[model samples]
Target: MIYLVEHFYSIQGEGRYIGTPSLFFRFGACNLKCEGFACSEVAPDGTVVVGCDTVYAVNKEHFSSQWGKITKARELLNILELYELPEKSVDIVLTGGEPLLYAQDEIFVEFLQVLHQRGHRICFETNATIAVNFFKYEIYKECIFALSVKLSNSNEPYKKRVRGEVINSIATNAKDAYFKFSVDAESINLGLEDEIFDITSHAPSADVFCMPVGGDKKTVEANTPMLVEFCKAKGYNFSDRLHIRIWDANKGV
Candidate 1:
């Protein structure tokens, strides 16, 4: 079964395709909590939850009420129709707590199959932990991947967050792919360069883009100067969390 946390039509807010008019499908659940990033929310039950900025999407126990359960590819297709988007012109971004968690689901694969058949460009904004079997799911070969792989800053262990073999596979097999790391001032001071270099080494052909880690506009602002300089020093591209910048702490944007 596939679960969709939310769907919206918005401009691509980060990475290679930033600002492009796009349709977003945010899936629920993820393998990593990324508590190190330190974004938190209090649930109705008075439990404090922590993780990456999209904690609501990750903590299903608290936010499942907002997620739409999907049983068929047609249902998603119908959701797309409501937007009345131009034929195959808008970029389709598959994002999540971790969208590829559903990689093997029959319905998930069917949705990708139909999207590809219709000529829409698909991009997966993933943490790069879950590697799709591109040989079996050949349709993924036609899509781009925004590899938002986690760093030590995420508080996830190296073995859990960084997968060298999986990184290489996606870079080598995907139609196009790139690395996008979420960094902060502290992580930058803590030798993030070495860690980032080690991961990117696994995918030599992919370009790297770094964006400040933040859940709100203020935090993002605080981290930006350092990250911009960091990117400049490393000759990497700098991406902004434009969605957060524009719609701070708001859902369904």
Candidate 2:
């Protein structure tokens, strides 16, 4: 079963393809709880939930009512129809909580195969911890991957966050892939360069893009300067959290 949290049509807000028109399919469930990033929200029962910006999608116990259990590829295709998106013009981004967690699921694979058959460019926004067998799921070979791997700033242990073999597998098998790290002033001061370098060593050929760590406009603004300079010094691409800047933490773009 595919547990979908939300779906939206919006411009790509960060990474290499920022500002591109895209349809997002945000799934629930994740391998890591990045509490260190510190974005929080209140649950329906008034519980103060905390984690990454998309905590609603991550804390399933708090937000399970919001997740849609999808059992068929046709349901997703029907959702796509509502948008009436131009034929193959908009990109398809499968995000999370950790979308790749369903890589081997029959329905998830069927959805990807259907989209691939229709000539859409599919991109998975993943943490790079879950590795897929591209040999078995050949359709994934033609997809793009935006590897948003968690860093030390996420409060996840190094071993849990950094899986060298998995990173290499995605980078080598995907048609196109890149690394995107979320950084804040504190993390940068704590020697983030070395951390990023260590992670990138696993995929030397993939390009790196870094964005400031923030779930709101003010936070993003406060961290952007340091991140920009850090990127300048390290020759990494600087990406902005454009959605937050434009909508100020509004959900669903």
Candidate 3:
């Protein structure tokens, strides 16, 4: 039973695959609320802290929004068909509220396999806290995993967030996996350099992307220079949250 938060067709607005046309499937429920990452005071609070980003889908209390009902795999496929991009090859981005929370399920795996068989490139935007034994599946070879590891500045407890062992295991085990970290100026100054070193030590060969934590143009602009400098000093790539810049943290983008 997968509770879909929302689905839409848009350009992939972040990471190495930025600006590519893609279909987005946002699933409901995240293990991490990240209250400290809130973008504005208008943001709602509860199990899910609502901010500029993903305001509509995440509820005020639990971050669980009213997104219709549980959808079967076949029905989801049908829904996807409606927004197919025929001119160019499309990438399917499975995002959250944490999609991996349900990725371990039989139906979800089957759906991924079906998508793979049809020649779709699947990208997973994951929190990196959950250990997905994706290597056990054939489809795993076809999928590109984006491990967006959360840092200490996210206001999440160490135990509740950064699972270095799990991240290391995934980095060592998974094929085509990359590590992306979300950081702010304060975090960069405090210990982000050390954290980045630790992550790269585990996945030395993987390309690392350091993205600024922002939900609006102002925040992105304010933080990008600092992040850019940090990345330059450490020989790392800097990623901008393009969706937030263009859409102002609008949901279903």
lDDT of 2 at 97: 96
Q: What are the RMSD figures for all models against the true structure?
A: 1.1, 0.8, 2.7
lDDT of each: 0.90, 0.92, 0.75
Order of the predicted models by TM-score, top scorer first:
2, 1, 3
- Model 3 residue 187 lDDT score: 84
RMSD after Cα superposition, model 2: 0.8
- Regions more than 4 Å wrong, model 3: 40-52, 55-65
Candidate 2 clash pair list: none
Q: 1-253, model 3: which lDDT tens digit per residue?
A: 6778788899887777888788998877678766667754342333334442554444434434455455567877886768747765588899877888886777788888888877778998888888777567656657787888777776778777777777776666665778888778878789888877765676678899888888777877888888999999998888888777888756666
lDDT of 1 by residue, 54-135 (tens): 8888999987777788988899888888797875578889988899999999898899989888888999999998888999
Q: TM-score of predicted model 3?
A: 0.88
Q: Cα deviation of 34 in candidate 2 (Å)?
A: 0.3
Clash number for every model?
0, 0, 1
lDDT: worst 10-residue window of model 3:
43-52
Clashing pairs in 3: 47-61
Highest lDDT scorer: 2
State TM-scores per candidate: 0.97, 0.98, 0.88
